[model samples]
Target: MNKRAIIIGAGVAGPILALQLKKIGFESEIFESRSEGNTREGAFLGFTPNGLNVLKEFIDLDMLQEDCTPGSIKFFNSKGKQIAKLDTAYQKQRYGVETFQLKRANLNKYARIAATNAGIKIWYDKKFVRYHEANEQVTAYFADGTTASADIMIGCDGMFSEVRNQLFKEVSAIQYTKLISTGGYAKIPELSKPLDSIRMTFGKRGFFAYSVSNNGEVWWFNNYFREQQPKPHEIEKTLKTEIQDHLASVHKNDDPLFSKIIKNSHEIIAYPIYDVPKLLHWYKGRVCLIGDAAHGISPHIGQGASLALEDTVVIAELLKSHKDYETAFRIFQSERQARVEKVIKSARKVGNTKTKTNPIAAWFRDRFIGFFIGKQIQQLDWIYGWTYSNKNSH
Candidate 1:
């Protein structure tokens, strides 16, 4: 009998991991807590070269790029003065592929289509509860009262993963970083005619980012530093009027561009930012964790989805030698810990730059951001330049 793996979550990492495993001689079933209807409608995501390369190993990116624009990023201060630009389309000459922008729903949609075409089975609305590992095999329990037996269990369920809660007893839990994020889409072709590039601003009040597409579709988001996490009910209350008025007041002392973006928003969403702390263990017995469940990084660096893709890539490669499953799990953590931890730390540092409230500190930040970070984009080559191959792994 072929080795069967049980995967939790059907989001970004889950479906892609399912495809990767299926290609590598492993049969797997994915269990998602959400029914299909709710998973769609995420705002937009930057799919960098590193993540795109990993996805290319399983499916054609051209099929997905038709809906996206080149992923060039230009940094600026609150005054709208350009600092530096990372022209990802041109950088493809150096990194083999360029970064691109796409709605998260489009990527998820394509991943599901690919997984379905590959004969993978996904059980929707099956929320994971706990797992039992005995006799060297693992069985997973779900909210729907169904069970699955597999040789390996991986948690790809995002940051607030129940799988991590059940398996990783050594760690307390994923912690909220007290940063509230809000984003929306707009149609402002006149103001955002330059669709080839993404514009990011480090403001005195907070951090703001916006991008325009050739067709007048604009994607934008803002990050605010909060001292306390908002309750579930409060989060729901940050809808159109509240978000618009709050954003208007926050930028009252600064540029009006950010206010314009907010005023033009079709819809807005607000949520607390969370991150996974350093883990003493990523796996125990026959079950392990992957993606956001294992190491949820803050979105400051915009590499969350890319890092998840990288995780699934390495896991699939290591799993090729099935008899040494324990060793695969062990080595997977060893290989990934340093990289993911560094990213998490770097994201925090990036967050700090956005939260500067003092006038003197804000002035210093805007004045020297170019001096310090202009060349820093090149330092990220280690991330965008990575490629997966058995020869490279050794």
Candidate 2:
């Protein structure tokens, strides 16, 4: 019998997995809670080489590059001192690809369209309420009273995953980082340098980053923990205060980049950061968890979407080798768990680096890490340099 897969969530991983399955002559369907292609009001998403390569296999890299802007990332200390500048060309040489920044909504729309064109069916407003897994097949029950069955089920439903709840017991749970992210777009008459470079400031108040989007909009964000109790209108009030404080701390009072950007800024949106510590198992029988559903990495690593795409490719490659569902799942979990655990640890460390309240500690941490992070960054070579072949080779 021909094998089929049921994918949860229509986010980055779901559509990509469905597309990869199509490449391997498997049929798959995606179920998403959102009724349309619009995303949940996300800002810019940075696609590292690891993610770009996987996407290039199915889509046109040149086209995506043209659609988005190619940029470099610059790191800074709390006092707006340039710590280091990442070389995009060197990264391309090392990983065979370069990073690009694109709007999260547009990227999702593109993936959704690509999946639809590849003949993958998507059902909206069909939230998976539960699942019944048998030795033969896995059936999903949606809150809309609809039922569907497939040969295999993969959950990419994100941190608060229903699939994880239905299939696997709570081996771990999402932990709040006490940090909040607030971001919005700003219209610029003209940027000094096309705003192609990312500027990040690290401080005791927290970390703030501002970069130009492909559409000539300035995308800026500030991350900080609440000093006191949060009221109902706390996030909104905090956003404005934080922005004002961030600009003042950076001595950007007269800088056109800061003044014009904030002058044209829109309403800010905020959300708390959450992630699972790690999962011992990502699968049970015919159902498996992928992306944030299985191991939700912090945005600190800036690898969440990239990791999700990587999971899709790796799991698909593993499944091709094993004829038995259980064996395939075991292989997938064993291979992914260790790597994900390392990433989770590294991400938390990076996040903590920005939250040190002591000025001396913050300075020491930033400078010490910045001067010696080349080795640490090189450790990521294995991840970004990975690719899949038809022969099931690593």
Candidate 3:
């Protein structure tokens, strides 16, 4: 009998996981809490070569590159002096894929379209409440008074995952990282020309990064230190104008270009950064967690989406080789836990640099930032060069 899997969440991991499972002759369904076609939830994000490789299995690179731009990052200090740079062209030569940046909504749209074309069923507005395991079958209960039973249940529900909460009963697993990020899109006439690389500035007060898309739109974000995490209501009620004014003030001491970008942005959004701490386990019974549900990494390294993509590929491959669902889930955790934890730690360490520092420390950082960045880039082969091979697992 073919194994039937019930996937929670319709985000990046869930849909892609469904497609991968289908390729291996397993049946799967995706349940999402959000309504269909309403994917405009976040700002733009970058796709590293590792993540792009997993995506390319299902999506054509040319189709995914539409409206996006290849991203080679150029770093600058507060005084607008170049400090370091990451060459995407060189990255392509080494990793077989170039890093690209695009709107979050566009990526989700492509994933959904690909899943639908593959004849996978995705149920929207189905909020997962809980699940039960008995008689070697796992059944999921939704808020809509419906139930779905499958041979295995996988959670791709993201950072604040309900499935994760139900599995471990650990409401405190997700922790705030004492950082807030705000970003927006702007159309600057003078800066309309597209550049080969994105510009990132370690400003006096915060870290700011911006890139020009293929269509001449400037996508930018600012990461700032906040001692206290903002209340959810506060974030929701804050007006775009208020955020713009605050960001402009934050970067006032830095280059004048940041001020111009903030002033010209038509809309702005803000969110607090959060990450999942290490868990003792990622599965129980026939239920397992993948993606952000398993380990949530902050945006400091731009690997959150990529890590999730990697999880899907690994889990799908493991399930294909291991007939026992429990063994498959166990091996999945063993294979992924160490690498994912390392990424989380790296992201946290990098995030700390964005926080407020003393004058001496700041000066030292500015003076030696390029050297540190160069060393880090040299050590990135393990990250960008990772590829899954089923033969190696046995």
Q: Candidate 3 lDDT, tens digit per residue, 1-394?
A: 7889999988888899999999888899999998996776767788999999899989887887778866788988777888888777878788888988987788888898899999999999999999999988899999999999989999999988999999998543677777777788889888798878889888877778888888898888877556777777778786455678878998899878888988988767677788786788899899999988988889888898999999999998898898888898999998888888888888888787777557787788878877887788787777888888765666
Candidate 3 segments exceeding 4 Å error: 239-242, 391-394
Candidate 2 lDDT by residue in tens digits, 199-318: 776643555677865566677766657544344486546666665556555435334455456556764556667777566678887889999899898777678888889889988877
For candidate 1, what is the lDDT?
0.79
Clashes of 3: 0
Task: Give candidate 3's whole-model lDDT.
Answer: 0.85
Give the TM-scores of the predictions, in the order they appear.
Answer: 0.92, 0.87, 0.95
Better TM-score candidate (2, 3): 3
Candidate 2, superposed: residue stretches over 4 Å from native: 66-71, 190-193, 227-263, 365-370, 388-394
Selected candidate, larger lDDT, 1 vs 2? 1
Candidate 2 weakest lDDT stretch, 10 residues: 250-259
Reference-based lDDT, residue 307, model 2: 85
- The whole-model C-alpha lDDT of candidate 2 against the native structure comes to 0.74
Clashes of each: 0, 0, 0
